[model samples]
Target: SAENVYKADGTIAKSGKLKTGFTAVIDSRTYVIAVCGDVTGEGNVNSKDVTLLQKYLCDNAELDGAYLKAADFNLDGEADNRDLVLISRQKN
Candidate 1:
């Protein structure tokens, strides 16, 4: 089966380069694909992504696929306070 790509907010993803945090729904599954550090899916790395990662750490939000991978700023095979600190330092 095939379906249109979707954003995390459930909207059809705009036609353009797929960046970090930009979500996709395919085959009845949802995934965040491409890049790293753009957890908010706005096509750029910034403070907003940092905030979202913070919320995720506190159990206030959810991140999967590439979103989770991006949060792994240190490539330590997990997203944690260390990754959070690194992400915080990189945000624009």
Candidate 2:
């Protein structure tokens, strides 16, 4: 199953860990993937993600599937202030 996953560049994802803002092809189906804390979906976890998460918390912006998942930095099934705080502390 792991071999069926791939990175956005169409290369085999050796570690099977796809980063944010990239796509993953699994069993031939393409899926937009996300990295924990990289809610802004720009491929890295940083201040931008923090700002976006703040807006999302206040309903000022929207985070679709992948982005939303990324926002849930702790994988707690939901994005909230807690996750935002944790993401803020994460280094790229």
Candidate 3:
């Protein structure tokens, strides 16, 4: 279901199942962007993202380049509990 629900560029269109009878219009002038704190690359912020940040903080995992940017929710040049807090507040 997730595979059938993505945009033309292949990112997940929404957090969960697509509602029946719903229609989406793509704006050619604009691009769908990944939300900040989407460290798991799921295109939405959730507990999984927070877990990734936690893993990175504990040195159990590492993030670099684009992943690093996503993990840095505060844009303060580091990944920490503050970023985790921000991400925790985000709902699908």
Q: Which candidate has the top score in TM-score?
A: 2
* lDDT by residue for model 1 (22-77), tens: 56667888665756677776777789988999999999999888778888878878
- Please report, as a residue range, the 10-residue window in candidate 2 with the lowest summed lDDT: 1-10
Question: In candidate 3, what are the lDDT values of residues 5-71, reduced to their tens digit?
Answer: 4543455557563322222445533322334677776656778888888889999988775567777
In candidate 2, position 34 carries an lDDT of 80
Our tally of clashes for model 1 stands at 0
The clash numbers for all candidates, in the given order, read 0, 0, 0
Clashing pairs in 3: none
Reference-based lDDT, residue 19, model 3: 28
TM-score of each candidate?
0.66, 0.73, 0.60
lDDT of 2: 0.79
Residue-level lDDT for 33 in candidate 3:
33
Candidate 3 least-lDDT 10 residues: 17-26
In model 1, which range of ten residues has the least summed lDDT?
Answer: 1-10
Distance from true location, Cα of 91 in model 1, Å: 1.2
